[model samples]
Target: MFHRSVLVQKVLEFLLTADDGVYVDATIGDGGHTLAILNAAPKATVIGIDSDKSALETTKERLKFFGKRLELVHGDFENLDDIVLGQLGYGSVDGVLFDLGLRSVMVEDRFRGFSFKKPGPLDMRFNTDETLTAYDVVNRYSPEDLERILREYGDVRGARKIVEKIVDARKKTPITTTEQLAEIVVAGLPQRVHTDVLARVFQAIRIEVNREFEKLERGLYAALEILRPGGRLVVISYHSGEDRIVKHFMATESRDCICPPGLPVCRCGHKRQIKILTKKVVRPSQEEIKQNPRARSARLRAAEKL
Candidate 1:
């Protein structure tokens, strides 16, 4: 089943600045937020894009009632500029949303190998057509590279020890299953953090397999450029790393200058492009989290083009 959208009410309040407008649901997973947008703004049109064709198909079916108001595309948000240009021809969008969280349907599919609880091939590509997979990350990556991903992507402590265990296990037999990798991770980490570390390790590999951070950075820039003046950009991220990137981008873009404090004159000449709507990152209510536990980690930030 599709999990409920995170911070849907906040999204609508921040995003629906114009009664009739164009919006982009950059990671339109299962169409939860997109559905809400269409319902809230009767005349608004949404360009829903996702790397997963399966997700697009499901959203297309679910949103068919809206007819041409919803256009589902099988593509990554990293190329949002081109996709938006293709649709609008010569203009900008009123709002763009990036909800960087996996859909519940994808995680529940054992064949996709997204969940550690589901024992299946270690293939965690958001787009199955992509060449890289979690299996390659675990079995083929060097200890140093593995350690770097675990440290940077997962915020995993004792990443070297975890990498050592993975390297040792794969040496005997190729680490081929999500269960195998999770078991190794749980064994390598301390008892106190075993559960959390196991999940982070899996997350690190999946992020690497999908090149999530890199794509996210590119997508953010594209989204900002396509937004018209006063247009809103709302992003909901589920991990600290993703949240950090979004926060930094909004903070940097909202400032007029990026020069060092000690500098006498501003050399960067950076102009402020956006104004932050949320003074602080927004989190889901406890009641919402109770209904959908996956919404617990979500952090939402919104900005308007200046």
Candidate 2:
């Protein structure tokens, strides 16, 4: 499972605050990090939440030995406040860990259409029950809409060229699969940047299909409500967009007055709610990256509730 989860040690180091604390693994993919938390803090209880039911099921099996210490919830983290509050009321969470990376299992599953290397239908919904899918975005979006997500979500170079290829290819026949899209992306990009752009295109479409940015924003704000004083909120995000969201959230929440820069006095009366634990963004060490190359892009930020 991609070296059994990236930066598991870092997660435990930053997130576990108490032996019998109630923690929430907001994206408990395969229970890797959650398992690490349980082992590190023997008396801790974890309410693991994920949108993917299959992932929760896999985690359930892997962590069955922990019994009631593991409470696997089936839902999106965007509802984090309601979910956590329902379990422990207000301000009761000891720690919250948002490991915002795709699982290796999900990426490797050809049927999931997450990997450009895999030939599969463009169905990259984390929850199969969700209405939108990668196919909807690729085959149906206008050239402008396609380019918007490519630039806004993917931040890929040559987005216009990629959109042109997609629009033209879809006119011949609908862009139906991951392989087709990857080929179109490659054909549109310069050879030097082709592979990276191809990956970005898929990632952009997947992010759009899942509304990942929207949910992440909502989840970050809502999570602040459930953290007890001194409780930690640790986020590990792999994408730049995801990292930006976490970074801004932490910065905004940690500030006492959010008035305009030139304001003489504080008008926005926003009391600081959190203390930033990591002054700068924390990243995985070279040793960890050597063990799991995917860990290289992980940006971790932590804060404690005030």
Worst 10-residue stretch by lDDT in candidate 1?
187-196
Q: Would you list the C-alpha lDDT of every candidate in the order shown?
A: 0.90, 0.88
**Model 1: per-residue lDDT, tens digit, 140-213?**
98899999999999989889888888998988999899888888888834688867887888899899999999
Candidate 1, pairs of clashing residues: none
Best by TM-score: 1
Output the number of the lDDT-best candidate. Answer: 1
RMSD of candidate 2 to true structure, Å? 1.6
Q: Using alpha carbons, what is the TM-score of model 1?
A: 0.96
lDDT (10s digit) by residue, model 2, range 138-229: 98888899899999999988889878888889999988888888887787346898678878888999999999999999998888888888
lDDT for predicted candidate 1 compared with the true structure: 0.90
For model 2, where is the 10-residue window of minimal lDDT? 1-10
